[model samples]
Target chain A: MVSTYVTSSLILRILLVYLMVSRIAFAHDANEASAYTVQEIAEGNFVHEGNFPPQSLENRGDIANIGFIVGEKCVAVIDVGSSLHVGSMLKAAIQRVTRLPICAVIITHVHPDHLLGLNAFTKDDSITVYGHHRLPKQIRTRSRFYLESLEQYLGAGNTADHAIDPSLVTPVNGLLSIDLGNRVIELKSWDYAHTDHDLSVTDIKTGTFWAGDIVFSEHVPILDSNIRQYNAVLEELQKLDVQHYVVGHGSLDRPWDVLISEQRRYFRVLLREVRAAIVNDISLMDAVNTVGWTERDRWHNFDMYHRRNVTTSYTDLEWED
Target chain B: MNFVKRILTFIGASLLFCQLALATPFPEPDHSSIPEWIMIKQLMFGEREIRDGSDDILALYLNTKLDDSSTVPIMVNALMDQTEDKYIKTLYLVIDRNPIPTAGVFKFKPEAGRVKLETRLRFEKFSFIRAIVETNTGDLYMDQRWVQVAGGCSAPSGKNANDPSLGKMRFRMDDQIRLNEPNLVQFQIKHPNESTLASDLEPGYAARFIDKVAVEFNGKSIMSGDINFSLSDNPIFKFYFSPQAEGVLSVRAEDTHDTIFTDSVEIGTDKR
Candidate 1:
């Protein structure tokens, strides 16, 4: 009778220890699921700034700043990141903040980093997608290439769930106004600013301008449209009256006008050097490396895209009088 | 312990020898003190002596670090004036490492103002591109740029494979052809110029490209290009042509698919 009692006691102790350990493991996993930390830039405005990493399997394409605006009735999401995984995380962040139904997803442009995470909102029938008027055409023309590149970076298994659906997109031809319950958001589409199709959003209640790629703070300014038109847009942006701004890339540490001035200086350098090369009868091959090299230390990723920028500017300006 | 030490010493010695072998300069004739230039000279000119050009007479301009291998922009300008006596007669573009080393052989008349040509080409590997110019007296002058980019011949054409404009040609020039002064003429042809090494290709198809291009004026050949996949999809060329008399300028292009595209422009006299 004594031996049986001792054996039973030992079995009970082991079972109890196993159950306690499992509970701790489960709690640890729950903490990891809500790892994304969001900062409130303004009243009812929440933003999640991602790391400045290239699209890869490690980061899983969460390399852009994405945010949400919560009003009395609904929510508006600005730029949903680069993958479905990131979109899900952003959704979790929204759920943590408010239970308000997401009313709209505003895509700033057609870049994969800004536009690919759109499918995460497709499940909700009430949510509407908005983009510039030229967004649909760009999506159709460039999606396949983007998808192929994504697969190369992230394996096919990760990319299988991500895609661009043009049919669900509502093209924003001009100024469109949306009411997120009590707060009013104004969306303006510009002509060949950062891209052929670029839209900027402004919250009337908070005076915060979500200036997509039109303005970059720490990152180097990338030019995809006409340089002359891009410079013209920058001059016009100086006249806008806004309290705070959220750029597409980099930190919101600098003043808006300061960022614009710095970018303008860089572009003017490109223009002056490119025009000189053409007059001197230099080839496009040599101009790319030699032009705009003086500004190498001022911006991040200067070596990667600045040469391509020179190429784009040179070809376009060659046609100019 | 003694045997193990000897084995370790032997392994280290072998690795050092291998590194030394790899560090040896590429075995070719010395042309410009740059190894790639020496190799290129051997590949293109063989035992022939290539004369370094005077800065005032000839200069070649191209991107040294190529961004796009398939369509690298290149320009060759004769620094010397084009007079009735001395002018550039022929221009040869050679990409040493490309499967087809000779990219183009262009013959120009004195009417071609100033002897300047601008075009885009494909590069298969990181190699030297030499632009050799032959004057009327058979003097050869060479200018070369070392490019550090590859994979021009095998890049995919980001277009639909089956398009109606395949093998179609389009020609652009001033409405009126001027005499004496050089006028810019551009010709564009639609073809995949598909490279075998390109990824995202449909299974079972090898590669196809425009293999030959011939430009003639009134039955006389002005320039001819023996091209390869190094030409980008929808190959386009913009060059200066001086018209002495009103004649028909015809272009003929043949692809690896045996498809021929021909187009002609009538050089009308400019009254102004």
Candidate 2:
């Protein structure tokens, strides 16, 4: 009886050790509150196991981040990086992991830093790029001008044509998901808060949520047509139980609940004070004068942005009522 | 036996990985508890153009909201009392607002003309939009757009959002598309208007706000003002100026750290 018990116990220990080794291989370097991983890539789901080389025209510093995820069996590439170089580099990275075919590329949003690598994803079947309805429109409208600005900013190393036709566009509505073998990726859309159309992604395997532009990590949240709606959305993000949040511009974070919570509190406070200023008939000047303005110090050259935020918030408050 | 040990070890390893994957950047954020004084971080001064996408003149009217020690109506009275000017008409107070509650712009008709002056103001959250105009008769009309950003005074910079290096700051001037004499100029830049409640990515660190800006006309001071973080990045601003006065226009901005950015351009009177 003792030998039998020992034999079973030995087998259990071996199983435990094997699982431990696998887990150790994929450990995350950053400190997080929780952790998880993918089990397998299911069939029909696309896999981004190839590189979509960035166009020769993309400027450096213009590409923020790049990567792709799988849904069921097909794959979806997240970012193509700055230029043709980064895009190609990412494709190679994708090839290293999976052999599944890449079905489409989701721009996430319309910023050059995020979508300039469109050329890499275009394929014979005409790889579809998804974003908010306004996104493809924005890409077609501003590609040239933005290209000029990018060239001026990053110099010639990112030289290439910047025009992208809306023909390859696939606009996403409320929420969409990619089913990896044993994983699921959830993509959600928000108003023009960060930009004209911001799309976020979620990995169910690890519960790592990718917030393209909505959740900025250590970077600035670029503004667009609306700030009121933006603030409201930021407040709403708090309602999610996100574990890992990968912002469009910064590092990933665990316990996204905290990020959303803090952002919500901020907008609420801003609304109250601005409302008060209006009630007292503070001349836009006196209101500006009477109330002291602060915060945003460490941001390199934030003065220029401060003025814009004020205008956006004030307009939102006024129009809201 | 060895296989069993390996499986057990694998389970242990995976548990450890999970902990790191879900670690929160900042265990606790400073959502509340920020002092009122610490909220407002910067002061800014600039003129807002209140016009459709046309060259026609816009009349601006204004209201005020000073601390109880001094009411907006009282402040307006005091301002008029000091300016020795009477053309300033109308006053409205914004209310239910957490910060200051009174401030609005006065609208102007085609006849309200020839206006140029700088003034100081207050805000609750860093948000305040306005329209200003002057009539040929010295009648000043202004429109105030109240905002709901309560943390405006000290809203953290955008850099506090996620990636600071992704910082993209710019200074630009948009040329007048229509007429010359009363042309509208577009001024814009980008920066993270940080909120006071905003903590550094590592947590514990608080973001700062903006302070001052100097607008120069031909190397001379045209408009110098204070600012706050209530502003947004890549702030696009529009204002009306005496288009007839031809000179090299330069703008220099200074924030809390005393960081200075100077960009200049020549305003062409005949661009229209």
Candidate 3:
């Protein structure tokens, strides 16, 4: 009779423990629903591919791909997505895969699509944020404008509630290397290319190049820097012997050189036509609509950005010899 | 006589009703009639020959739908031949609904190649932007484009207005002045050209901008402009002038801050 009583208590305790453990598991599973589906592109490399859409309430600015690399000791996040919610999902994704501590969050540029979710990782003191040397100035100057745009597109409630504080950023002036156990990642800050403050990351083990916006896959290239300088950077990028490249936009399935050549063609057309327009004394008004228009069919979202690109390139190239 | 008077009254009433029923979405200018335009024309030209631009001698180009109110691009091309004897004497950019109707006044000499001028502007509201060209013979030809964009004069100045180079002036011209030919001269002044609407959002800040510009060739006024917030930040003006004699082409710009910036480009003779 005593043994029977102990057995009943034992079963009850086992059931209680099982209920508590499942509840905890269920909580994490719920978060995983919102979590990104990360694919292992290489050994210990995971990438979440996002849809190609403009920043709107429907998409909630989930229009840029973000991923992370796992080293033997820790992990490095390439980008944190576009909002605090997306960032939280990314963190959940990391937890689902491994329990390793996040060592660094590397921001490739100052674009909101890549940097707005930075606050998600800021709470963790172990994670150090890295950006280009010019990033702090850009963030200071442009953060307010970006926030205003974010509120307009994503609504006030959906915004990440993050403010750009330069003090928290560790600036990468030139080439710097970070060791994640057995893996070594090289970080390089580029000159006026995609933006004045653009950083690229390369994994020495897998030979994977994380080229922020420097290499766009399908999205129309935006020109915020000197077009001449951008072209020179593209030439320099072509010479690099990279095994695989992760671009800021478009499909990563295409070969790295193919994407580079395609981008180069767009830049070349813009330069040739804009210079010709300047020499022919065509006014900016006409040039904005007509210059480099032949490639309209080749690029996606060509109508949204091509004219502005022409305007930027024209204004910049007019001063060129 | 009584019958004729009754018919005239009926016609005038019908026309007024028709105008009110047009239902145009844009806000029409306060003074849109021929007589109203002539009143401003008389105020500006003072008994000059003003005629409708039926000949299409002057063309004004602007985007019908503009996204950026602060920096609007505008181009004016004068098709009339410009020679020493006769050329386009002046081009007046008139935005009917702006706080200042005269956006800019550009003077051109024969040496200005093709009589083409391009620059950026600011529009206060939805209205017609007229490019009135006056030839050397005192004949005025007008062409206009109805722009639907607004909020240019009163839009926020994205940059902080407290910068130190608020009224610095810069000039770009040919190193060698082509005498008796049209040489292009461009000048830019660094100022926020703040608008009252922009000031409304910032506490303890008042609107300020370059209010006047005087361009002189050899101390003779080529053109002078009275500007307001309708000009973009760091207001730029590009025009053509024939260097009559090698001297100085000086520009003096004054802002609401009571600061005057003066710059001059020496017109040296071109090497033969």
lDDT scores for all predictions? 0.77, 0.47, 0.77
Ordered from best to worst DockQ, the candidate numbers read 1, 3, 2
For residue B262, model 3's alpha carbon misses the true position, in angstroms, by 6.8
**Model 1 per-residue lDDT tens digits across residues A1-321:** 999999998787767656655665688557755667788887877888776645544355777888988989999999998877788888889999999999999999988888878888889999999999888766765576567656645532456567788878888988999999989999999988888889999999988889888988778888877899999999999888878788888887688889989999998999999999977756576788789899999997687678868866875676555
Worst 10 residues of 3 chain A by lDDT: A151-160
Candidate 3 lDDT tens digits, A1-321: 999999999898778766765775698668555555888877877888877756544355677888899999999999887777677778888988999899999999888889888899998899999999988766765566567656545433444467767778899999999998999999999988987778999998988899988988888888767788899999999999888778878898988888889999999999999999977767666777788889888888787677767766765565554
Any runs in candidate 3 off by more than 4 Å, and if so which?
A1-35, A156-160, B1-60, B65-71, B76-117, B121-213, B225-235, B240-272
lDDT of 3 at A19: 71
Better of 2 and 3 by TM-score: 3
What does the lDDT read for residue A34 in candidate 3?
Answer: 54
Cα displacement (Å) at residue B236, model 3: 3.9
lDDT by residue (A1-321, candidate 2, tens digit) is 999999998887777776666665546322111211111222322222221212222122433545677555667777665555446555655665578777768777766667676776675373557777766656654565456645644434455644566767778778887555566777777765776578887677666666765765444344544666787777677776665455555444334665565445444545576677755434344444433244354232234343444444553454343
- Candidate 1 segments whose C-alpha is farther than 4 A from its true place: A1-33, A156-158, B1-71, B74-118, B121-220, B224-272
For residues B1-272, what per-residue lDDT tens digits would candidate 3 score against the true structure?
34444655786675555444332345544334634356667789878776666366788878764545566788777776687787787878887777777877767656554476667777766667788888888888888877766666654554457778666666677667777777777777777887665564346656788888888889887666777777777777776777768888799988888878898877788631
In terms of lDDT, model 2 sits at: 0.47
